[model samples]
Target: MLRTLLLGLVTLAASLVAPAAAAEPVAEPGAATTQNPISSSFSDTYADPAVLRGKDGWWYMYATSDPLHEAPSEFGLMHIARTRDFADWEYLGTVFDEADRPAWTTGSSFYWAPDIRYVDGRYVMYYTVTDTVAEPGPWNFAIGVVTAPTPAGPWTDSGGPVVAPRPTGNGDYFNTIDPALLAAPDGKRYLYFGGFHGGLWVTELDESGLRAVGSPTQVAIGDRYEGSFVVERDGWYYLTASSANCCAGPVTGYSVYAGRSKSPLGPFVDHEGVSLLDSRVGGTQVLAQNGNRWIGVGHHAIVSDVSGQDFIVYHAIDRNDAWLDAPGGVNERPTLIDRLDWIDGWPVARAGAGPSDTPQPAPTTSSSLGIVSDDPAAGEALRAVAGSWDAGTDDDGDAGAVGRLVPADGADDAAVRTEASAPREPRVEADVRVPTGGRVAVEVADSGPSGVSVTVDDAARTLTVEATLGPRTVSDTAPLPSRFDAGEWTSLAVEVRTGRATARLAESRLGDADAVVGVDLPNGLARPRPIQLTVSGGEAQVDNLTVVAAHQPVTERVAEPVPGDEVFAEEFDGDLDTGWSWLRPSSSVTVGEGVLRWPLESVDVVGAANTGPLLLRTPPEGDWMAETKLDLDLGSGTVRNYQQAGMIVRVDDDNLLRLGDVAIWGTRQVEFGKELDENGALRWGAHLGGPVAETMWLRIMHTIDPATGEHRYRSASSRDGVSWRWGATWTLPAHTEPSIGLYAGGGATPATVAAFDWFRLYEVR
Candidate 1:
């Protein structure tokens, strides 16, 4: 009651400050702050953050529903806050009160992931309704909208869902939540929504901005992306989404990734040309925890300062103080702000520096920033080689000039070559229509005899990358999404960097796609060469054809195993050691021949059951690392509703971390899972990594956050035991002795045994 009263007083005080009539033409920039987490003015968890510059000149921020403080009765109904400078914020309570929530929403329903936008002269906010009064269970998620005269006001709910609860082709329904609005320049409004259950999708909204109008198009694949946000820069549409687990107490691996396309609705692809829908999954990392005080950096909003510099406003967990009160309680994610930079046509948080922990300059608040292009225009420094190519106007009904190349009666290829030498690492792009039955090709890093050629077969709707050596040619083909229309102007691109070449076919003028489908070339280009564009068998008009130096390689950095002193080792050659204990002892587990064989169980430790037995053992006195070699193969490309076996670190059934090679759906992955109790409810969070082998090595490194003495554990796995893949880290409470162990389960699969070669613990170096 005290907390509620304090919040009411604060809201009333904030309301006294009148809105600015108009933004200043040249506003003064805010003073630099000493460090990040610019929203540190507020101490509560503010997850799934969204920011909108109000007409009154202040930037209003909204977050998912949660209690403002430790008081359970003081829940916030989608909290709201505002700020003049991006650093210090003023909490203005929440958007809804107990009596003002949507009528369709039940008392237990939680509002989440709010997206605020001003369209058609009014403020429109779209949010997620976790469960409605009419429908319940299995995640009956829907998108709800509300409108108000101003950023803060007496808003009116639209009465019902803009996006009704939807079902996937499978028996289960899609997790339709996380709605983001993009008020396009062409008087069209597109809403990007959905979550881990249904993937990310985009649908056009009616003029009223309250209902969906057209069929929705899937953007990112399920189990990979959520919290979809779209922003346009230099004519390219970037789709940024959060990945991994959002809530796992201290172990949440939530991070942000991005992909871009030319069209508002697209077949978006990452920097390496990987499609978001591909099973291998593709995302250029935007923000991630870089071994700092912060973790789970994701679900962000991008805003700009008056000076045009961009800033990413998101939430992150401080390793030292990860939870509200109890170890397994609600995660304490606070809003943070950092500079967002664009590198070579791609957006990276802090110029790929990851999260910040030091003093930084703040954003200027007086005006608005717009997108600016740094890339040079295309079709320059090029000359026709095979056919008479002439400059033409608007070939495909679009308002733009195009280079038209019509091959003669029997000509095979109408080619154009760049007069200037191409860079050693070059990216070539062209916007051209696929002649009814012919093909369009872009060749990069080409010498006289050898080069990489990317061809798009319009008839087959396939993108192929072929490497040509004196007499040898290697190629790989991937089918394009049906949305890539041959009748429309398609953007084709090929980027050659390092030792591989990537080919992409975009619905826009040019872009990237599925990285897994890209092909490896021979030693890259030894010398500078010329790029070429070819049209075969028919006449095609090309626009925006350019070749420029590609950016430095963008790849995932594998975590190196920390060296330490050996403390404990179990070979499994003898009967159970006295150090090991089991939560629910199972007779199916055996020990012999230097191995421990545990058959997959039909139990789980998540949710309410908590019945899966875990083999338990304590570690050394201080920070330590645990290593284990497991020979468990759940098979490849098969549905095994999950059979897994690996190492685990636990404080109990409710709060623990598990890393195992498990088969989920059709994908075999290395899963890092966290199970915790949130406000008396079981909450499970997980993130996945891949390339599992029949025999693999898994390790967990544990340390303590010096500031708060919280226990931190990081996960790593290796297919060959030589190179390790480090995953996100999770945390435990201070001074607590959580046991480290091994377990395997997640029913519905054929019998399989998890063979353990050894278990070892070592003191931190």
Candidate 2:
């Protein structure tokens, strides 16, 4: 799967005369700078990228380039870029050129697969520079080693290929390329490398890291693969590699696959126990074509940040922006970066999809949350659609300011539309403030069969639903109590449900009131229409205005649930009774007071698709019942949305049963049902929520109707941690098999404490 990388067209006319480019500019989180292929002023053609943060604090990135790129005959082979932040990058120069070629090999033109290592005092780089065209297929390339005092090298080569291609045991095939090294628990270094038509090879290397000690051991897999990268986490060795045609522009079917082994070498299999060699069968798919806008997504490097969060840096040819069609870009391999989360025993990016278009959490370089400014122009959340806003200002009026909207005497400039919300209705929210006689109102057009315009005006304290041009059939009105306070901020929201509309207002979460009326917006305005805001005079400042498809309001009451026939149950006396295994370790997990005390991190179990949580697994499945009583103690921090912990049923990472608290700002809501990340790297679930209790009994039941061969899942919770009242049951897609587990997570402040009294599993008798 070797194809030419696109980034080698430009060569600085100046060689060793000047050092590679360097700089220090950082972009705030969620800024456009974090977008895929990120921002690089240096090179658009960068590919086969290998990034390392140098001792100087600048991230130095090296990559392969077309040997044809015009440069000094003595110029280095790999292209380089350096940056203080990951977003803005400055292009550096080559690592080696023709004049710096290894002695054993004649002058070479082709160079790719560059890897860097900073050990002891000097820097070591292993790269593929061998011209294998003279040999047969199955990739007959070898790697060479070079050393220099710094990542920005004034180099010296090992004089020859440190690892070269040789005949296999069958004496028929051989492979040698894409070298990567692992510094194992032992004092020795293990070199991992290979390519298409060749099995991955792992060999022991001396501390020098340039020479192999003995013959290499070929790691077993099903088929040919390349770009071998091995990393060890939690005593597990994960080998990730790229397979198939990695480059061919839009049609390229390249993808990344991974498998884990206790030992660094030898056999590795996917979740299905199928050999990675048989990728067609299964091999923990890491990233595949996102299909929305990106393609040819493969040949990646997995590296971790200071926060221990992993990132997958790779090159992909954009569908609309392919480099081959661009000037001087004969190949179109553009580099991209995405966060990678280790789930179960494998790594998964957003939805296991190749590259996501959805905005991701800002790159986690540090453990703390990176907060961007709230100024509308600088705010990341409000970047989608800048409603007709002229300018903004604050007390300083220097820069960071909220967007100011003023209605013209007679013009449509005061209103603008954004993405429309659906299913039930749109959740429109924004933090607004008015001076003296000013007002801000939001209006949505409903083009549905039975729709009308719904407007909420705080200044007038009026909640109105009217039909602009219709038979004037549906209508309703409600008074907003103390809706607006001059010169003060207001949290405004409108939940437009079919046949009914509810408007909620609050200064904070406290002192909140809702105004509900049986009035529907014109169904004819099915799409997002300009939110009509009419200002007679005065001016208003708007900020934190966000529009999302919010969950429906919960209206369930606490009560004892009806119990079903019992099957099997566990009441902990001392330790975790046999069947339970700690799938993931936490800081402290102890059993006492007839409970399993679990303190979850600030991360929660959102859509059960991308696995990560404090999970305790049990081997039980099918038409079964798993019930547990959980008592959540705030410890030091309060629960927030995507926080709180509870019981879950799992088949794997992508498909699972989750029954837990989905909180926002310490307000608790219980969400129950099967959750999956099947929709555009986002969680797509058909679930419902109810009030949450600190001490509640959670139950998940999977049932089957033997006659019709139908399977369904039901969930319920009780305030007493005993009896539970079940909700509407939902059937999962056919092949879903679920195992029971207890999960607690909330990657946030103060941490979380959840203690489980006992867990019991039962099958209908």
Candidate 3:
């Protein structure tokens, strides 16, 4: 299927450019400048976008576009767009065109989806062509091929159509478009294609790339339209496509849909058990429309920018005023772009609305930044150096006898504090140890009525403070001077003389001759503080309250579980235990929770589990139900596989019932069958691939009628002591039993540890 699809679209090897009008930059509002759409002025349409991140730090976006809006063109052109930031797009021109017109597609009027790839130093563009007027036949379209040296090309076609329309009886006879090429990790090339009027199909292509190596397989099918694109991430192949009505503006719309499969060819299924084509948002809707305020979104392409930011580009009708009308109505729709973020491996658009136009303080980018400190308590004060203070006027009054502190980024309500008095006790101390060649900037915010000078390392570094009645933020930058001496610690002390204040340290960017020293904030201050911090913006916070002392400790106890009498226990000496009678039910007991839990052992004994069938005075008749929970230890202290443990329902002795294990053969395989051996012991079989180790839980359910001689069985298992997979149902000859008991057998290797919680039998209506 891949080879056939690839052949159809790779015949043309020439590059052609569309004569598009030059785009003019529009003057946008301030908000628009920061949050403008990536493909702001380009006329774009989404088919299936083939995205590739080139080694040159550019993302190449190639997709099919309608050459002349509504008019039919001979072939589709592969449009290319490049970008670094998902928010900004750069048009890279068309990489494939039908100017030379390959013989097979010359008369065809439409090019559907074009997938592009850069392989072996050459560019390959795969595209599908549709003929509005069929060549006097039922099948009306074909997939063609084109190629180029660079993404932008000038000439060459593959001579003819690589993949033609299928035979009349084939399922994909209506159309063979929307081709998605995937270069599997194992060096194999696979192609997935199909669209509206047909289901998704897959086939392999030989290394030569001229034909399909195997029969094309129908992977998914439905009544609605479907387009396919394959992307591999983290070893998982994701098949994403658009569903429902696309391309008819807002009123006539569509939405994107996706699913995953381990193989290139798939039994693709959505969350619901429906084919991708028939899968719609609810009923008739296609792609959901999304934009600033508009809906009706469809035709999407997912690409990653130069900076490795993923983005989704799609066309949406901006119908804020006009109603979405069909049958040739005038509606202007434009292409929009939004950042795509991966949440739990799925694409989400425009996830976080980060800061757009808000100005931030310019980061320090110098080599030799230092700190100045003077402590009045240490008897050192009023010291000024030449390059320490800027000669700018303090318009906000945050300047002391020295220069004023400039608010770099329009800080609100900024003020300067100048307090001259006896030095107060240091509220907090920090050891300032700078990394070899880095500088640190410390920021402080004042939350008090007045401003006070803060001392660092007994050195009085004047911090101009701004105080607002509510909340005011003030900041200061301090550069660390020298490299740290190994095994040596430096201390920084902060003390306030008159007013109360709190400070915090932010971040530290790492570098060489430009390293940053971390500052630690002291504890017990009224404000939030940093304990040990790095240079980027690490600082300690202090409040008006004084430090308090420490106190003592206490102890407490919780709850526990109580054990009951052992109704049945096997010491594992290869012998059957006593006090256990597995019985067949007539009007009592049933498997409700998959596995039966002996209620006698549970806190809510009667409510959660059941206990009976001890001494059967009469043989119960009619249909019966039985189940048991088996706990097995596989390995890694967890259950692995094939650990059979459940109930033997309708047992004449032990040879006529069933058993079930949830986790079988590494995969969950449910089993239900009749016992073949006549040792009065039933031999039920489960074909799970491996051994069972750690604790695994299993449950078995059976319904049988003694008079009618009819019986049915079901089984299930769990790993975490909860949850079970009910196996396929089975039936057998009915039997009578005056006595029945839960039976558990150890595996061939006898799982080092095995146990059964409980068992029960009942009759269902």
What does each candidate score in C-alpha RMSD?
Answer: 13.6, 24.4, 23.3
lDDT of candidate 1 over 214-263, digit per residue (tens)? 79999877777788888876568899988876765555667788889888
Distance from true location, Cα of 660 in model 3, Å: 40
Using TM-score as the measure, the top candidate is 1
Residue 621 displacement (Å), model 3: 61
Residues 477-567, candidate 3: write the lDDT tens digits.
3432222221122223333222444322111100001111222222222232221111211221111111111101001111111112323
Q: Where's the lowest-lDDT run of ten residues in candidate 2?
A: 12-21
Model 3 scores worst on lDDT over the 10 consecutive residues at: 506-515
Collision count of model 2: 38
Candidate whose lDDT is highest: 1
- Worst ten in a row by lDDT for model 1: 10-19
Model-by-model lDDT, in order? 0.70, 0.55, 0.37
Arrange candidates, best TM-score first.
Answer: 1, 2, 3
lDDT of 2 by residue, 547-627 (tens): 443332212221212445666666666866566665546657777768887766654445432435545555454456777
Which ranges in model 2 have alpha carbons more than 4 Å from their true place? 4-33, 67-76, 132-140, 167-173, 277-281, 323-329, 351-353, 358-361, 364-765
